[model samples]
Target: MRSLRQTTARWLAAAFLAGAALAVQAADPAPIELAAGVYMVPGTGGEPDPANLGRTGNAGFIVGPRGVLAIDTGTSYRHGQALLAAIRGVTDQPVRLAIVTHTRQEFLFGAAAFREQKIPVAMHQAAADLMATRCDTCLKTLRSLLGEDAMQGSAMFTPDIVFTDPLALDAAALIGRPIQLLHYGHSSGPGDIAVYDPRTRTLFAGGLLEARRIPDVGDSDLPRWREALRNLQALPVEVIVPGHGPAGDKRLITQVERYLDQLTARARALVNAGAPLSEVADATAMPEFATWDQYETTHRRNAAIVYLRYEREQLVK
Candidate 1:
C-alpha cells in the first residue's frame, strides 16, 4: 500500500509538470477587430513569464484616412514588430502617430519600433516626466523580470511630443472619423490617458483598466484611480480597449471600479483593525478574487501599498 501511494504521488507530480509545460508554451496575443477600423490585440496570461515575455499588455491600432495610429508599441522589439505586421495584414496604410498612455516599461519599450518607422510618438507630459526620470531603473527591473532574451533589442524611448492638454487627432480618419486623446487626471498612474474615438464609440483606456486581471496598485494612487474609473463610468463609449486582456465595454470599467472599491474598503478595514501590512493580504483575501490571475503574486504588494497610502494620508492629516 505504501508503494502504491508513492506511485500515485509520482503520477500526480508528472501530470502537473505536463500541464505546466503546456501553459508555458502558450501562444501570443492575436489582434481582434474592436470596431470597423479599430483593432486590438488581446493579451494572454498574467505578468511577464518566459513563455509570454511580458506581452500581457494590450496594443492596438486604428486605420485612419491619413495614416494608421498605433496605440501602445507593446513590451519589446519583436512584439512591436509583430504588431506592425498585424497592422500591415489589415491595411498597407502608413502609421502616423503612436500615443502612449502610461510610463510602464512594457508599453514604453516598444516605442523604438514606431520611431524606426519614422512615426512620431506622443504621450501625456506626466508620463514623459516619469519615464524620462526613471528609464534606467525600469529597464534594469524589466531585464530581471522578463529575462534577457525577451528584452533583447528592446530600448525605452520617450514620446516625441508630450501633451499637457487633450489633443484633437484624426487617426480614425481612415474610417472617416476623429479620435481624441483624453487625460482624466491621475488614475492607474500619474499620466494615464484614454484614446477616445467617437466614431466607433471605443475608448482605448491604457492601464486604466485591466479586465480579468487584478488592478495593479503598484504605482497608482487608489483614490485617484477610483476617481478615474468614476469618470470612465460616465463615458458613452460602447467598447473599451483595456491596457490588458480583450476589448470590453462599460461593464469592464464597472467591474474594475468594484474591484478597486473592494480592495480599498477591505484594505482600509484591515488597516484600521490593526492588521499588519504584511498580514493584510491573508486577512482580506476575497474568495471571489481567488481565481484571478497574479493574485497570489501581487495581492500582498497591493495590500502593502494601500497600507502605506493610509499611513501617509494620516500623516498628511
Candidate 2:
C-alpha cells in the first residue's frame, strides 16, 4: 500500500488530469433556482483545467428576506466573483454569511473572494484545521495546473466562523427558511458537513456526497461514511446539490451509499482472498459503475485504499 502522502499526491495529480484531453468547454455559471429562494450554480464536472477555470464544484445560495447565505465560494477568486455576481443578479440582499462546506480545493480558496467582500466565512473546525495544514500545497498545485492567470488573486484565508457541533441558523430571521449545518464525525473527510433546508427539503451535501462522479476515498473512513449516509437518509431531503455533478433528488444519496458499499465489499473480498495490494485495483473493477466520471482514476484508487484499510483492520483484530 502507498503511504498516505504518496496516495494523496497521486490522487491530486489524477484528479487534475482526469479529462484533460477533452475539448475545452464553458458552461454558464448562472444560478439555477431549485425552489422559491434556493439556487444552485452547477459545476462543469471533470478535472480542473483552464477550460473549466477550476470551477468543477457546485456552489449555491439560500436567499431570505433578511439576507443571503452562500453555500460555497468556488475554486478560485474569479470563480467566487462569478458566484457573488450570480447572487447579486438575483437579489440585492446582503450576503450575511458564506460557508466553506469542506476542505476540498474546489470548494475552498474562493473564500478569499468572499472575505474581500467582507462577507464572513464559516467552516467546521475540523475542515478548517485540515485546510490549514494542506491547502497551501493545494493552492500551489492549482497554480501549477490551472496557470497563474486563472488562479490570479486566489489565496486562502481563515474562516470567520468555526463550529464543532451541529448548528441551527435562525429560520425566523431567515424568514421561515430554516437551515441546519450538520457534521458527522470524520466521514468523507475530517469535517464533512451538509447544509439542510427543511422548508424546501434541499440538501447542499458537500464532500459528504457526490452524484454520478466516484466519491474520492483518499481521506475517507468507510464505516463512518456509511453511518453518516444513513443519518442523512433519515432526513426529509427532496433535492441534493452534491459536491460534484448536477442536482438530483433523494436517490443521489442512495446512489452514493450503494457505491461505497459495493466498493468496500469488493475490496474486502480481495483482502480476505489474500490478493496482493498491487493487483487489488485491477481485480476489483466494477463494470456497473464504469460510466461514472473518474471511474478510471478515483474508483481504482478507492479499491486499493479500501483493501489496505480492511487489511489493516484484520491485522489489529
Candidate 3:
C-alpha cells in the first residue's frame, strides 16, 4: 500500500503535467481553413503580452502542388515553431518559401525559425531596410514584454530575396495557382506589400488593412496609404487576411479607407484650428471606433501623428 504523502505527491505531479500541456495547447490554436488550401492562424487580438506570447498578428500558409508558401511568421522563435507545427498538422508538403509581409516586429522575428529549416524568406527591399534600421530595438522591447523564455532562440536575419517591384511567383509550376506580391510605395509603411492569391481571391493585406482594430499610423503616409487602398479596392478580392484581426472580405479595405479618411480629416481640422499637439488625441475622439481593439492607445497615437504632419505642412506653406 502507498503512503498517504506519496499518493498526494504523485497526484500533484500529474496535475502539474496536465496544466503544462494545456498551456502549450492554448498557445497553439488550430489554423482556420480560409479556402481549399489556404489556412489562417488567427492571433489573439490586442497587445502582445506573456499571456498571448506576442502572437498578436495573424500568420498563415498556402499549400501548393510544389510545396508550401508561408505568410507572416509569428512574433518569436517559439511562436514560429508553433506556426510551423500547425502547418505540418495540415499538410506534409515542405515549406518552400516564407514571406515577411511587412516591417512589423510581430511578423519578422519568426523568420529565424523558417530560415533554420533551410527555407528562403523574402521581403520588399524597402521593408528590409527599415527593419535593419530599428528592429533590434523592437526585439529588445518585445523580449521585455513577453519574457525571455517565449523569445529564446529568436534573432534578426537578412531576407534571402528582396525586390523593389512587384514579383509574381510562377503560378503554373510553383503553386499551381497564381500568387502576386503587390507593392504600393510608402503607404502603410515603407514598402508595405500585400499577397494576392488569385485562385482563392484572397488578399493577405499585411499592415495595410485592419478590421475592428485601430490601424497603426506611426509610420504611415496618410495620403499615400489612401492611394494604396484605392488600388486594392479595384482588386477582385473575396477574402482578406489582415495583419492584426480576424480575416474577412473586401469590405475590410473600405473599412480601413473610411478610418483613414476620418482620421486625416479630423486631424487636418484640428491643425487648421491651431489646436496644440498636446490636445490632438483628446480632441479627435472617435466614438464610432470606441469599441475597436487598441482604439484607446493606437487611435490616440495616430491622431497625434496626423496632427503633427498637417501642422508641418501648414508651416511649409
User: Which candidate tops lDDT?
Assistant: 2
Report clash pairs, candidate 1.
Answer: 64-174, 65-173, 65-174
Q: What is the lDDT of residue 253 in candidate 3?
A: 87
Question: Which of 1 and 2 is ahead in lDDT?
Answer: 2
- Per-prediction tally of clashes: 3, 0, 0
Model 2, position 296, has a per-residue lDDT of 95
Predicted structure 1: clash tally: 3
Cα-based TM-score, every candidate: 0.86, 0.90, 0.90
Cα deviation in Å at residue 206, candidate 1? 0.8
Task: Give per-residue CA lDDT, model 3, range 58-116, as digits (tens).
Answer: 78888988888898888988888888999999999888888888999889998888888
lDDT of each candidate versus the true structure: 0.74, 0.83, 0.82
Which ranges in model 1 have alpha carbons more than 4 Å from their true place?
Answer: 1-29, 145-147, 168-176
Candidate 2 local lDDT, 1-317, one digit each (tens) = 87644543443333333323221465547677776698888787888887888788888899988889999998998888888999999999989888888899999987888999999888888989999999999999999999999899999788888878755444335433578888889999998888888877788999988878999999887789999999999998767788987677677788998899899899999889989999988998888789988999999999988898899999999
TM-score of 1: 0.86
Please list the residue runs of candidate 2 whose C-alpha ends up more than 4 Å from where it truly belongs after superposition: 1-24, 168-176
Give the Cα error of residue 52 in candidate 1, in Å.
1.4
Structural RMSD, model 3: 10.6
Q: Predict model 3's lDDT versus the native.
A: 0.82
